[model samples]
Target chain A: MSLVDLSKQVALGIDIGGTNTKFGLVNHRGEILVKGSIPTDEFETPEEFIDALYEKIQPMADEYCEGKEFEGIGVGAPNANYYRGTIEQAPNLPWKGVINFADLMTEKFGKPCKMTNDANAAALGEMMYGAARGMKDFIMITLGTGVGSGIIAGGHLIYGHDGFAGELGHTIVKPGGRKHWSTGSEGSLEAYASATGISITAKKMRAEFPESVLNQYPEEEIDSKTVFECAKQGDPTAIEVFRYTGQKLGEALANFVMFSSPEAILLFGGVIKAGDFILKPAKLHMERNLLPIFRNKVKLVFSELDEADAAILGASALVWEK
Target chain B: MSLVDLSKQVALGIDIGGTNTKFGLVNHRGEILVKGSIPTDEFETPEEFIDALYEKIQPMADEYCEGKEFEGIGVGAPNANYYRGTIEQAPNLPWKGVINFADLMTEKFGKPCKMTNDANAAALGEMMYGAARGMKDFIMITLGTGVGSGIIAGGHLIYGHDGFAGELGHTIVKPGGRKHWSTGSEGSLEAYASATGISITAKKMRAEFPESVLNQYPEEEIDSKTVFECAKQGDPTAIEVFRYTGQKLGEALANFVMFSSPEAILLFGGVIKAGDFILKPAKLHMERNLLPIFRNKVKLVFSELDEADAAILGASALVWEK
Candidate 1:
């Protein structure tokens, strides 16, 4: 009823990471008009962090959104609760306890704000702008430093009753298997399927296989990227590392498949760059473990969103979700 | 605007089991006015089964709905597909291959029909008429001859992309632990959590623990009921059987909780009769496995619906869901 053109609206998207924060002004068509970053750990408090973000982003919003109305602000962060609009006890983040993130953002920006966990935001991004476009049901698993997941069903992201659903990374895959380095939870998917987990595997495997190319690198430098490089050069032990990682991932994927029966499982982040070394075994074991009804039906694919801009895009997508 | 009395509407609910087919006329308030059953295995063909079902149900419908309008027919069967409205390759059911169940029901009854798997129906029943009332997110696990599960997220039953979602029973818990009797899948939740699994555990544990009261029972007679009786009589081996089953069930439950973050997990069927013998250990293990944020939050409870009327009530829930 008002004269303001809703079609020319733009949203301010913020991706709050432990090390760095990315902010962008995005249009309705999923295009980022302007973007910038700030080191997240430099701030002593959340208040300081918000001030720093506002200083950098306010000018960009003013410049890029001259004729357009500001839709709102959307944020993605570790341990962020969509229901409570707070970040609670995020191990990776600088914050010590629950921070009323959405309220602070809304107060500073003078606009409505929405927030969810980073994994869930990424899933929303995938659903809106990436491989899962038009898909009503799908799961997004990010195999970065730590494994993270977001589940979507019936064209909506599953926030659970607590706004903390879809913690597939924390789901125990192997009972009494590997001990997680940080959480102390044994046999969780994060203990084996993560980039950190892959590095641990590489170190252990290289110890057993001294002649392998993985041994050529220093213990500190040995990681998923080095393992992938070695596997590309046809190193047997390096290839074996990915096979083992993929087997665990596949077995976990099969369990996930039975739980949600998503049309496809989209893998994202650094570990997915291993390509066929990981994908082939993951596909094989996933199919091997699935029931006859589920077998060969679920598609396993990589995210189509450009990795550099995905976080900002994912955060922005949250604004347009409704 | 149609002038038929909407408040007096009733739905015909059918629960097709492997051994018996139970049907009832249920009102909008989840009250079953009349109910009856027929042997499911006696029929050679699905057509004969449908004819027999019609013969018994049509008269009940007519008597119960003298003034009330017939809303629709709702069927809960093994391997029933909500999307396709078909029953495909159900091992327990007499009919083989895919039977167009919903279409056949509509043609025979001259009413629109809705269908879903029995587990999903039970979940709907629990949501609408039982313990899960007013709960948008909960899981219903049926631990009878086999473990069956239905997941409800955001107040709607999760049918997945293919209408075959929420098969928590088939999700691998033990990895390489136990072989299933029929499916041959190794280490599924069903292999350890079902009543059949309890019997198997009883037989296995009683062998290891010689001089236990479980040793007195014949191998064939040592079912879940027998185990419960022995446990009540202070038999350690029988008690251990429940503990082991509950441990496995709890571990799998933690995985489910992580997947959907349901507020409550409602346990149904014969296995729940073990009471604290299973509940205590299950609670302990489920809590132990969950991440710090999820611990001690999800309420694990038993189904509130009377077992005798649950199936019929659950089937009727589908009709009123919209």
Candidate 2:
């Protein structure tokens, strides 16, 4: 591959997901070019995941930015912590010990690097590009398999004292209630609000609506999409499941809005694709639960970033900082 | 007072509260020198409130530091916002419009000035001279009539986009529970956890156990103190109230820990005066509900700052920035 023209001012954005690893070139403005993704194969350990991803990405970097300018690398990954720059015991990737993933990138690419959780990076992405553009303060939530979120206050991602500052998912929405079984993390809206959460709610609704279309779906295969498709088809049980998810989500967000008083909450992830069935209830419930001061004040909007490019753009934006 | 040392760089701390307005002089280290307070007379308007406070405070400043060397002034008020240097409609105070309270002091005192909310000032006080000394990040919750709180991240007060961050008291634990009525703000922890919150719980428990000694006290007069006294006397109702308050407090804080992941949450206010009755249960409930990653990690500690001195010193310290 031709060496990309040297600018020494751009950055590499890397997003590591449960299923795929995405890469892109991003600037400080949150702009990206030449984004691509490769599968994240099941690795027995962290070593294999790192080696496989680096092998796939190194050539792409050489081709895209050959003799081109690049400053640093930024990564967004599950369980990635800004403080530690590692994915610590993340369930999806099958990594246990602290992985110095950023260091590995730096060693291979010889660039300054940074990393944060995918949700947090998405938040940064929105701040720099998508829905929350020009916004200094906002909360970004990725409601996928589980409810995950990030907080930006005063134009910076709030890492709190520890790097784990934006765990809006685990903020208890329902006490003593069945929530996402997040490795023993209890009372999270994630269990009831995410795709996994909707599945759980759908599973419970089986007893409530035994003859519904949901009865046809096997227990192991009941993802949010299946339920959403059923809801789209006017399946009562599926519709009810989405409503229940919104209720829990709205209630949880109302609680979160108090602490951060964000200008808006940018919603991303696969589950939100259900659109108003999920959002209408979530918005109504959120507004219902909010204080008069915050009523109709906090904007809850959907993410505009292409699902695939979000990771790389988010991670790259970190190192692409102006 | 003869011309007080003209060369001394002393900072004036002005803490404006509903009941009274306190002003004190201090060095960089936050040691109180000319400490005093004047009654904050009831006012129908914000101008009147300021006029009344300035009427008394101006003379005192004239008398004490007329010819002495003085630096800047710092003001802490309920609705005060540090970014805009104004106090908006504070819940406790009868003020409505934007009042340049900081400018009022600086113009009168002939010095530079700083201002922030009471909770934020209290947080700063902890950072400077209290239990949070040397701590870069922490949350300060004052369990008074309302559960007011302050957040400091990376050693800076986290005033959100519009300087309206850190409303910890209002984070809802129960969707529509006890605190719903009293504040009329909808499901606030402050309704159930503050001193007045304890009173609310106690009053409800009082009806359940009217035969108890609480019957001797007027229902309206049964405040947090009465409840604490009852707890000291081994009253089951009062004890249960404290336990419940602790549980509620813990749950809310557990949510906060998820977002902030702070080193600790410093408990303050007269409500926390019950000590272990409140702290122990709060700790237990927080631990029980916390995410696994934060199981025994985040510490819950007490504020050692003298309540009066803390706010006063906090206002003073505002001008005495780090």
The CA lDDT at B314 in model 1 is 92
Please, what are the lDDT tens digits per residue for candidate 1 over residues A1-322? 6686656989888999989999898887778899999999999899999999999988988889898988999999999999999999988898899999999999998988999998899999998889999999999999999899999998899989999999999999899989999888889999998999999999999999989988899888998999999999999999999999999999999999999899999999999999999999999989988999999999999999999989898998889887
Which tens-of-lDDT digit does each residue in B36-84 have in candidate 1? 9999999999988999999888988888899888899889999999999
Off by over 4 Å in 2: A1-8, A29-31, A36-39, A42-52, A216-221, B1-8, B42-69, B210-221
Per-residue lDDT over A147-213 for candidate 2, one digit per residue giving the tens place of the 0 to 100 score: 7787887788888776888888887888877745655656677767877778878888876888989
Candidate 1 at residue B189, lDDT?
A: 96
TM-score of 2: 0.91
Q: lDDT (0-100) at residue B271 of candidate 2?
A: 89
**lDDT scores for all predictions?**
0.92, 0.80
> What would the per-residue lDDT of candidate 2 be over residues B1-322, giving only the tens digit for each residue?
6665534667788888887888888776667877877666477765566576667666666677665657778888887888788888776665667887777666655678888888888888888888888887788898998888888877778887667788888778887676455446666788889877788788888888877777679877788888889889988888888999999999888988888788989988898889999999999999888778778988788888887688888887787566
List candidate 1 segments past 4 Å from native.
Answer: A1-7, B1-7
Please state the error at residue B121 of candidate 2 in Å: 1.4
- CA RMSD of all predictions: 1.7, 4.1
